[model samples]
Target chain A: MSILDYILGSRKKTANVAKDRLKLILAHEREEGGPDYLPALQEELLTVIAKYIPVDKNNIKVSMERKGDFEVLELNILFPDQH
Target chain B: MSILDYILGSRKKTANVAKDRLKLILAHEREEGGPDYLPALQEELLTVIAKYIPVDKNNIKVSMERKGDFEVLELNILFPDQH
Candidate 1:
């Protein structure tokens, strides 16, 4: 599916996984862009995720990976100290 | 102020911190409750924060601290590999 499609599509549903999840997908253009755009995009993506999913906020875990023109953000809502 | 106050009050305004922010505050009852409540509360809080803020979602960072009966969730929208 297209980037926009991914953003607008329904999230894969399943039973509680002992943790909440925040997933962010970013698409970049091949043309020239500011260096800061990637990180800014990353931050904005997190913000969007934060607003939707409910987590301790303090206990939330964020992980990221970047490809040619796509970035993925994985938010883990699991508490480390407890389990 | 009281626990309820913190939850309902306005968030302190500040400039873009080169990162987005997610904060969760949890209050517990004095009486007995399920042991799972704390982590559950944490997850819910992160979900709420993710929904409200815009971030790369993939690159988001989550931190948490607990004291007494209160838990604080601090979400950082900073990109680790980038910045």
Candidate 2:
């Protein structure tokens, strides 16, 4: 079953609910790739994710690094208290 | 700047930091799409997102639905308390 099927099929059982987590890393575009590509890709991913996940805008945690070829962007969302 | 740059570039300023949120949907694959494709795609996205976002696995909210030709899977992440 696909993720949708899994989620829907198991909705009646709280034990089957999947945890929510997301991570995205972006690298500087190669000379051939162009500098603008990475940023654009990241933006697209965020836009897509935002459209589906319901997050408290105020609680979002984002981190970034600019070390050498490894340009990384990390996002962490801490779910609220659960039963 | 790409998403990584945007997040990393804006790290120092809380206001500049992006909020954390994610959403994913899966549909029944068409004959051309293959029955397994939708599930696989959803799995791939979740795996990628999980690697980047830090969330309380227990609090993750997942919802699913199946209606005729449409099957939908939705994921929502709620961040913990923030300043």
Candidate 3:
């Protein structure tokens, strides 16, 4: 293990891995009924949002939901408040 | 407003809300294929695990997935390492 890993503790790393795996699995599960559009949608959203604001691409999150008969797309992006 | 809320700022609260909503929506989506067994399954799993180890029920997570027609159940539980 690296010095950083040792300092942080292995349990903390395991927790992070679990969290990330959960996120990916959940994202995949939510896209099951759709046409597998998340990758393209995420790319498109990042491209458009980047034009307006300096955002963290890695932090961007997108999900789709079916509400009754309507579909809702949720986009979450993290950007710095100050330049 | 409470002093805790003021000290942390509203944006952090908003971020937490977003994260929580995403988690719930994802959990709901993953349960679409199954017969809505998560609540029961979670309870059962916690009951079983708690018999051996003192676990935080609120921190336990359960997810089911399909892999090549096989079903997989994933469980994550957080417990204090120290007694």
lDDT of each: 0.38, 0.44, 0.36
* DockQ agreement of candidate 3 with the native complex: 0.03
lDDT of 2 by residue, B1-53 (tens): 34443433533354333444333333331222223333444555555555555
- TM-score list, all predictions: 0.27, 0.34, 0.25
How much DockQ does model 1 earn? Answer: 0.03
| Candidate 1 lDDT tens digits, B8-67 | 233335522333232222222112232424455445544544453433667555554543
The fnat score for candidate 3 comes to 0.01
Pick the winner on lDDT between candidates 1 and 3. Answer: 1
TM-score of candidate 3 chain B vs. the reference: 0.40
Model 3 scores a C-alpha lDDT of: 0.36
In the range A1-83, model 2's lDDT, one tens digit per residue, is 44444433533364233344333333331222223333444555555555445455554566655554335544554333333
Query: Number of the top candidate by lDDT?
Result: 2
The segments of candidate 3 whose C-alpha lies over 4 angstroms from its true place after superposition are: A1-83, B1-42
Considering the two chains of model 2, state its CAPRI-style docking category.
Answer: incorrect
- Lowest lDDT sum, 10 consecutive residues, model 2 chain A, at A27-36
Question: Relative to the unseen true structure, what is the C-alpha lDDT of residue A38 in candidate 2, on a scale of 0 to 100?
Answer: 38
Query: Candidate 2: where are CA atoms >4 Å away?
Result: A1-83, B1-19, B27-29
CAPRI quality band, candidate 3: incorrect
